[model samples]
Target chain A: MTYCVGLFLDDGLVMLADTRTNAGVDNISSFAKLQVFSTPGDRMIATMTAGSLAVSQAVMNLIQEGVQDPETGETATIYTVPSMFRAASLVGEAVRQVYRTHGKAMQEHGLSFDVSILLGGQLHGRTVRLFQIYSAGNFIEATGDTPFLQIGEHKYGKPILDRAVTSETNLIDGIKLALISMDSTLRSNLSVGLPMDLLVYRKDHLEGPSLRRITEDDEYFLMLRKRWSEAISEAHRQIPQPDWGF
Target chain B: MTYCVGLFLDDGLVMLADTRTNAGVDNISSFAKLQVFSTPGDRMIATMTAGSLAVSQAVMNLIQEGVQDPETGETATIYTVPSMFRAASLVGEAVRQVYRTHGKAMQEHGLSFDVSILLGGQLHGRTVRLFQIYSAGNFIEATGDTPFLQIGEHKYGKPILDRAVTSETNLIDGIKLALISMDSTLRSNLSVGLPMDLLVYRKDHLEGPSLRRITEDDEYFLMLRKRWSEAISEAHRQIPQPDWGF
Candidate 1:
């Protein structure tokens, strides 16, 4: 299991994802889940995927190929899309294509062709947007009321987001809340591990990777871990005791 | 959906459950999920159920009827059981009975007759014990290593228990933490709601309850809600901001 979150805030956007991937408990490996698509000032899109690694890799590979090849006018690629919505559609098409290629073989082996993705970015002239793409190759956009989206082991980390996140939140503060939410889940569940990947997209910047790669030993995450532990214990101590008799 | 938690500590045992029951977003009702059985100084066992409400209700009804009858050769009804382990077994048997009687009928309607229960308390000469009974009538006892157990909508409230609960913690403090855990879930989900029922059990004293019935307008819970919000926000503010551009 993995935990990935994407936030679309008024100031910009924030995305975070864990690096642990496994076929089973003993087969764990560190794999980067965040994929960045950029073309100078034209567009910038970051995708963080969760579920079966095979299907995600197939979809991502098809995307990279489509973007690199400028041949016969085939279905549009992320780089060629004029709008964020079209870019999301392009990603969905790739997912469908990958399913046509791998779904049958996976089913024969009793494995699901499961894959879901968090896609967010900007197209130079338009506003920033975010989407959660399902395995069925369909998607839903994030609205102003619910500015954040999460996948995989989401429940343990959802309460913090429900209470603390809002559309007007700034990028830096959004990252802080995202990390803290992940911190809480990491403490409670062993399936989601460290070495996270995070990116902050400033409003209209069409080039991604503003900031990336949080290693296991990053000082900020370490401080966040220690501080969160202390904060929870401190909060538990501060609540007044209930007055009740036996 | 439901949220119920049971804790076994050196000071005593604490069990809390929300009253909200829903067949979907529309069919909502306040159905008590907790059942208490005590035989004076001999034993005190509390059982909290979650999952298919029909199945759980049937299980509780059976147990309630068993205590009032003499024909059912089940000598191990919770009220008549001699030890905490036997009482837990009785609860497990009740869960299995419900599943046997209702499982197929529910399956015919494309429903799962799932049931999970949290049982905790003590008998005359034993220490407090908490067990999580499964649909199969199998159960596992909580140890000092994992002192608390939760069922249904558990993830939203788990971080607090993971961080703050231990066998050495005091009974009143345990109850407070349990309430806070429930508070977090209540804030994040519509499926879990009030009026909450809480029970505290002393190690050897059986018979009646210690503290119960936390209604919506209860002043103590209201104050707890207000103070906890303040405390958490304060804790967040008190944690110094990251020096690195976060």
Candidate 2:
């Protein structure tokens, strides 16, 4: 299980992914689920994946292999895709290809070919865009009305998104809210754990600043965790408990 | 889909259920997912159901139809259960009976014998207890360390429980917290909606004066819905988004 969220805000994009993957309670391991594709000033595409690690890794591998347009034999890779839209389409096409190749055999063994991809970033001259790509390889682009997308273990962290996330939100604020949402989920569920993979891209920068692994020693995250817990306890103390108890 | 939560606390028990049942987005109807069985001053058992409505309803109905114990010719029902633990077993047994009757046919129809239940309340001469009954008819009782069980669309309402609920919580506060949790789920999920059914039972007081249907128009519920939304926003505002966000 995993939790990956990408926020597309006016200032830029905030992408966060937990590294925990578990087949069962005992078979837990850490795997980096956040992938960054950058060509300096030309393009920057980030993908956070959840679900079958095999399917997602295959999909990512195939995506790196690029796609060829049937009309013209020219190949379009993430780095070469003409627009953010095409890059997203190329990513979706790669997922479709992987599904076509590996989906059937996996299903026979009672495995569902599950993989969801969050692709977000800028491509040179194009506007910053965000998309959630499904296992079927179909994808939907985020718009102003719905400016963020979450995949895997989403529910435990959704309330904050519903209340605070908006297209007009600043990217940094979006990051904070996303972290809090993730923090809430991490506290309630054991499947989502650190070290977290966080990437923040300022629109048009065409590169992510501060790509880092957030481990236990990370000061900001530790502070955020402690402060948030304290705040909740204080909030509970301040709020009047219901008068219904005998 | 439904969202129901049953909490066990020092004050007593708090059970809440949303009233939405849907076969699909288009085929939605309101069906109470909560069932109460009370013998006035002797016992009160509250059950919240989730998953395939047919399986749950069948399980619930079978529980309602008292069965003769093979060892003893006497029949037993929820109200007749000797303890909350026995009551939980009876509910689990009824679920197993439903599976025995309908599991194969549902599987043939490509549907799951998917049913889960949250049972909480007290029996005469016993302490308040809570149990989570799974589809397989196995159940786990809630201990003081973890005094709540949630079923159906549970994630959205879980944070509040994680923050405020304890074995010693007040019933009125428990009720309010449950409402706020329900309100969060209602906002985030179309499959889970109003009107919600809420029951507050005081320990050892089998005669409940606090069970009611909270519809869209009920004044107290309306006030709660509005106040909760306001409280969330106010809380969000008070939290510093992040130094980075600024």
Candidate 3:
């Protein structure tokens, strides 16, 4: 299990992903789930994945090595995609290829070929975009009305994102909300662990993104965790008590 | 789908369940998922169901009509149970009986014989107890350290319960937490909807626990929903921003 969230805001994109992966309770391990492909001054695309580690890893490996476009016979890679749209299509195509190869064998063993990908970034001449690419190779982009996308262990952390995020939100605030959302998930579920990767991509700047590896020793995250829990309790305390004869 | 939660505290028990059930997005309806079996001063047992409507309804019907105790060859009902532990077993037995009768048939029809129950209350002369009964007729009790249990669409509402609930929490605060938790689920999930049923059982004085059917017009619930969302946003606002230089 993993928890990855991406926020598409007015200024940029805020992406975060947990490193924990597990087949069973006893087989837990840490592996980075955030991948970046960038060309200085041209494009900076970030993708986070969730679901079957095997499927996601295979898809990522194919994308990193540059997959061939089935129709054109030309190599299409995340770094070389002409637009953010094509980048999403490339990722989706990679997923389909992996499923086509492994889906049948996995199903026989009662394993799912499921994987979800969140693609976010900007191409030099194109507008910033965010997409949620599914296992079936179809994708949905986040628009102004719905400005965020999440994959894996999503429900536990969604209420906050649903209430606090919007297209007009600032990148810093978006990062804060993403962390709070991740905090809620980490607290309630053991599958999504710490040492998360956080990346912020400023809309027009293609000179790469600010990446931070958040771990237990990080002072800011520690403060945020403590304060967020206290704030929630304080807020819970302030809500007017039921007046229907408690 | 349903979102039902039960909290076991030193003072009493808090139980809440949403009413909406659906086979598909278009086939939705409101059906009471909470049931109370009380024998005045003798006992009061509240059970909340989640999962296949058919399985839950069948189990409820069997419990309501009194299931036979295989060991004693006599009718065993919630009202006749000697202790809260036995009451949980009674509900589990009812569920198993339903599964015995319909499990294979339901599977053949591409349906699941899936149902999870949260049973909480007290039997006179015995201790107050809360049990999360599984589909397989087994259950685990809520202890002092982990004093709450939830089922169906539960993840969205679990963080608050994880952080704020405990064995020492008073019934009023417990009920407040439960409502806030339910509010989270209601906002994030369409499958769990309005007109929830709430019940609170105080230890020892089992004379029909307090019950409230919260509908869209309920003033207290509406206020709680509004204020809780505001509180969450306010909390989000207060968390210190990243100092890593935007």
Candidate 4:
């Protein structure tokens, strides 16, 4: 299990992912699931992955190596895609390609080909965008109405995002909400552990995203977690108990 | 899909369940998932179920009809259970009996045998107890360390319970937290819908559980939902935005 979230606010994008990965309870390990593809002042694409580590790594490697466009005979990679849409398509094609290669073998071995990705970034003049790519290689973009997308162990962290995030939200608030969301998931699930990767992309700031690797000892996150818990407890405590006269 | 939660507190037990039952998104209806078997001064047992409606209904029926002990040839029903532990065992046995009768047939029909139950109550002269019964006829009791159990669409509602509820929590607060948890699940999941059933049982007050059928128009629930959303938003807003020097 894993948890990765992306917020596409009017101001920019906030993408956060935990580093924990496990084949089973006993075989837990840490791996960086967030990858950044950037060419200063040109394009900055960030992707956070979740699911079977093998499949995710394979898809990432495929995207990095580039894939041939069947009709044009030209290889296009995440770094060279003309638009965010095409970049997403390239990622999807790479996923399909990986599926074509390993999906059958995995099935025979009783392993499901599971993987999902959150891709969010900007390309020079193009507007910032966020997308959630499914294991089927298809994807959906986040719109103004629903400006956030999450990949794994999503339910635990979703309520906060549902309540606190929106397109109109500023970039700073977006980042805060994303972290709060991640904190909720971390507290509720053991499979999603610490050492998180966070990226805050300012809309159209193609130079690059502000990145932070949040570890267990990260002071700000520690404070945020404590404060958020206290806040929630206090919030509920303030609500008068039901006076149903039992 | 359904959402049911049971919180065993020092003051008593709080059990809540949504009434929605769905075969598919298009085929949906409501049925009472929370059932109480009370013999007033003797015993009070409440069971809340989740998963396949058929399986749950079958298990409920078996418990109501009473299962005969194979060794003693004595019939044992929920109401006649000697202790809360025995009541839990009875519920588990009921689940297994239902499985023995329908599990294979459901498998042949390509349906997985799915059902989980939350049973909590007190018997005369016995301590209050809460147990979560699995489909395999196994169950685990809630202790002071973990005083709450949830079944079905549980993830969305679990974090709040984890953060707040405990055996030491008062009954009134337990009720509030349970409703808040249910409210969270309702907001996050479309399959779990309203008109909920809420039961509060004070420890040793075996004169049946105080019950309420919370409809959409229930004034207190409407107010709680509104206040909760506002409180969460306000709580998050009060947290200072991260100054990560983006």
Give the per-residue lDDT digits (tens) of candidate 4, residues A1-246: 899999988899989999999989999999999999999999999999998899989989988898987668899999889999988988898889989999999999999999899999999988998988999989999999999999999999999888888899988788889999999899999989999999999887888889999989988888888988998888888988787988
Can you tell me the DockQ of model 2? 0.47
**CA displacement after TM-score superposition, residue A186 of candidate 1 (Å):** 1.1
Q: Tell me the docking grade of candidate 1.
A: medium
For residues B141-241, what per-residue lDDT tens digits would candidate 4 score against the true structure?
99989989899999999989989887888888888899999998988898899999999999888778899999999888999889899998888778877
Interface RMSD of 3: 1.0
Tens digits of per-residue lDDT, candidate 1, B101-136, equal 778888899997688989888887777788998989
**Which clashing pairs does model 2 show?**
A242-B173, A244-B172, A245-B172, B10-B167
Task: Please provide, for model 2 over B4-112, each residue's C-alpha lDDT reduced to its tens digit, 9 standing for 90 to 100.
Answer: 9888888788899998999999899999898888888888888899999888888777777885554576778877778888788788888887888888988998998
- The sequence of per-residue lDDT tens digits that candidate 1 reaches over residues A1-246 is 889999989988899999999989999998989888898888888899999988888888877777322244465677778888977877888888788888899899999888999999998899999999999989999988999999888988887788778898777678888998888889888989888998888887765547668877888788877887788877777877877675
- Interface alpha-carbon RMSD, every candidate: 1.7, 3.0, 1.0, 0.9
Superposed model 1: Cα runs more than 4 Å off = A67-74, B64-74, B243-246
The predicted structure with the larger TM-score, 1 or 4, is 4
Per-residue lDDT, model 3, residue A244, is 61
Tens digits of per-residue lDDT, candidate 3, B129-212, equal 899999999999999988999999999999999888879888888889999999889888877898999998878877878899
In order of appearance, the predictions have TM-scores of 0.94, 0.93, 0.97, 0.98
